[model samples]
Target: MCSFGLKAALLGGVFGLAALPAAAQQTKVTSQGITPTEIVLGTHQDLSGPIKSWGVPVTNGMKLAVEEINAAGGINGRKLKLIVEDVGYDPKRAVLASQKLVEKDKIFAMVGPLGSPTVLAAQDILLEAGVPQLFPVTSAEFTYKMDPKNPQERLKFNNVPPYTDSVRAGARHLIQEKGLKKPCVLYQDDEFGKNVLDGFTQALADTKLTAAATTSYKRGASDFSSQVAKLKSDGCDFVVLGTVVRETVGVMAEGKKLGFSPVYFGSTATNVVEVPALGKELTEGFYAVGGMEIPYRDTAKGKAKEWAETYFKTYNMEPNTQSALGYNDIMTFAHYAKLAGKDLTGQKFLAAMESGDVFQDMFGSPPVKFSPTQHLSATVFLLQQIKDGRWVVLKRDLTN
Candidate 1:
């Protein structure tokens, strides 16, 4: 077998199926904790391509988490070994990458593989392999949505909260908390946008509040003048958005040009780098609810402190929401892989994860809760807004 370095040697054994001899076990085993030295896992990201907007930082976050775990003597003394492939948010590439990770890398679990379409592509393979997929980066409902057409879809598990969940919370806060009544809706016309709208509707269902006007844009659209005009004509008091960074800025720019200076509310994606940078003045009142904490806060402690220090120390960049979330996904799974202990098959690790023993040890959000029937974690989210080119927490679920 190929040498797995000093960390592997310290753990004293190789991962293999129960039937294999120790010498040959390393050659064939695909499960984690089956060996003392290493736990193999897989992930897909947009490391070197167009989607690197999120892929680069997210990948770095996962790397930092894995490195930190290994330095801390690993889970049960077994170092995590991640095999990452970049899919650039392309669905076909994601599917291909996922297949290779399962068939060739022999990973015991999966993490990341960002973007809604990419995750949607890789979903079946992960489920069929029975490998635990922890904390994917997308908020698409289908990431953990119950299959309406096929009852079996409920078996899917993910650590990400529903996109709708955040949207609902944001909408409610916009109405009840922020006192924005006649809100307009702007969204990209796709699965992610639809989910956000669905949540917004559900939040105002009881109060009979609805969008003053709604306009849709394609995912990569660079212009939002027409949409902004509609909202302006409708006299919207606020505008809720279901868009990625590019469109978020575009809408804000057009709204500004059209003299529609309404407070902005958006999906958690608004907390990313572009929103505040491109729409500085307009993004001031922009609110988003998501998993990650506001970085550089004094109260940052425990996992948050660790992540903040290590992330900056290692990479020299502040970890963003996507980055923190990506890191959490991998480390939490590694925690479960260790808990499974020396027999880390898919079944064993999945069972361990389902036990919900490890809380969200990362710097953001509350601890997680998982089970056979529930794989999503951090059901609650913190509300944040941009102030002076940075994100700050505005409100948090008191339960955490």
Candidate 2:
């Protein structure tokens, strides 16, 4: 889980579901109804908070998928009923929002809940409710560790590969393929940063290469001149960053000012629209790995392309990969929900997801697949670099 400050954000209002015996069934508001009229599903997102940049567009993408599905005669003659609540990227807000969705809205499943911290806060709630949270937006490790023996009792039905996987792939490419002997890391001092560092360290276990220096920063800090100066003095040739847009640009600019430009690498969160637009030259040649596919209108396929084209034509703005990721997540859930058919229970929904079928969606390079044991799908990531004015894929697909 590479979320920056989601845990502390849940201080006041966050509430865990009441602990009950394993045999206890979640109180369903109404009887199971999967007919020709409606199939209700719920989601939580950050519409107005630190991560709104990723949340708003993703919600739009989910809406688009629901609209398209409804238009195409619905799923098994039943229209999808989606209920979304704003979590504001706060774990407390996420808990409250999810509670409303589960207790009041009576949704069958949950989709997004963007931040890793937020998703973690709702884990017990969803599990206690016996509702399958399909394709949560965050990649936190605890989000997928469902070993009951381990007292922590984390769930493992996440859709995307863990953030550790992305970091491992990128770090291997940097050390083995790119041959950077003196690598450093500019990481936010949080769970997200630690996750990336764990992967990077694990990848460099056999090799002699070590992180020459490590710098930690807060999320909203504006200046990084001293940190970059320290990196320059450390003689680090490459730096892997674990931060978001504002901080990422600030550090790179500081590096340039200190006359110490290294091959900058970062987490998937760097794929923000403001980076290239505002940072300009500072963002060039920076690399990151992401679960989303490139947003080229021409190369897209089937309903995916059609959705992109229609979105562009209607809004007159280019959609980023986040939209596609959101679209794919919701669509994939709907596909399984449809496959679940009349027996619309949480176990049935989970079974449908783990049916060992590779589904081609508008999200990642490789299609998504699940097995009885494997809960995570879409293991492949695309390594992209900012070239010219846009992000171009450096490699087609790097399966972790």
Candidate 3:
């Protein structure tokens, strides 16, 4: 009887030893940027550059989100902190800023870093360090596309629909629904512009249509005379703008000057209040594709209205589409952070996001979903037109 009992005890000990590896595998792994009391994230923006029009408001939106989250007892008892640096819309400065954030500040992840060139410049360094690049502002396709040759490229995620997809939707609408032909494109000579051009080209191909003309301009060029003149000469009935706020205005203003009043359609880059404010009456009748509904102060309802009111109270200014975008991205991050559990790591945070959860922002538009292969959330867009110095919803959610 004593021998049998000892054998049983030995068997139980063996079973417990055999379970160790599995338990270890289930244990959470942690790394830098997470402390007992906080999680640190970083971003670089064009604080004093040509795009400061967007950078300042986006940063302000992020700050407000962080403030609200921290005030409400933080995320799982760990407060959130963001470290922002200015890259002045320069890729070299972006690299330097990212190096400081990763090597010196030791940020766990980068959230809402502005500009396609800036993100492309710094992505490799951050990904190599096993840091997640989360929700960069630009909709450049490379920001989220996984390289077939390298599976290690899974650390980057984009919250906005790719410029390709946004343009495709708009192009389909213009060609099929509006029955307009003679499409032309005016794009910047960079990744951001390239993505939009790709989308426009693809859409034309898909619909058995062809471009009347395509023109490119250097980044930060205030004058778009030659490009606009080319589109005018091409007799394009509709012009797709691969431009941001100022550039969009510049191109359209140039077109207006030339009496070239083609129906202008722009990607999400031009979907900002500043466009209308800067371009004034000239921006009127322009169309843009956006992933989320713009919360117009006069017509916003329910949660959007409340958010706008609070934002106005907090920032003492009106919130635009960019502001809402910045706010939504941070809030989405917070949501995934909660799902990542208390022992949060960059990998865990990413896993939480890729777990196929549907996320709906303050606006009652479509939900954003992510998976291993799909990183860009908010795949659909609503077509909006500027009327009476404001964006008026022209069409509901559109997908290509």
Q: What is the TM-score of each candidate against the true structure?
A: 0.84, 0.85, 0.90
Q: Residue 258 in model 2: shift from native, Å? A: 2.1
For model 2, the superposed segments whose C-alpha errors exceed 4 Å read: 1-36, 150-156, 272-274, 298-303
- Candidate 3 on 188-296: residue-level lDDT in tens? 8999999999999998988888999999989999999888889999899988999988999898888888999988999988988999999999899999998777787
Q: By lDDT, who's the top model here? A: 3
Cα lDDT of candidate 1 equals: 0.70
Whose TM-score is higher: candidate 1's or candidate 3's? 3
Q: On TM-score, who's better, 1 or 2?
A: 2
TM-score of model number 3: 0.90
Q: Candidate 2 — what's its lDDT?
A: 0.71
Mind giving the per-residue lDDT tens digits that candidate 2 earns over 105-224?
Answer: 877777766877788788778766666666777776766655534322322467665777887787778677778888888777666677777766766664567779888876546778
lDDT per model vs. reference: 0.70, 0.71, 0.83
Name the lDDT value of residue 125 in candidate 3: 80
Model 2 vs. true fold: TM: 0.85
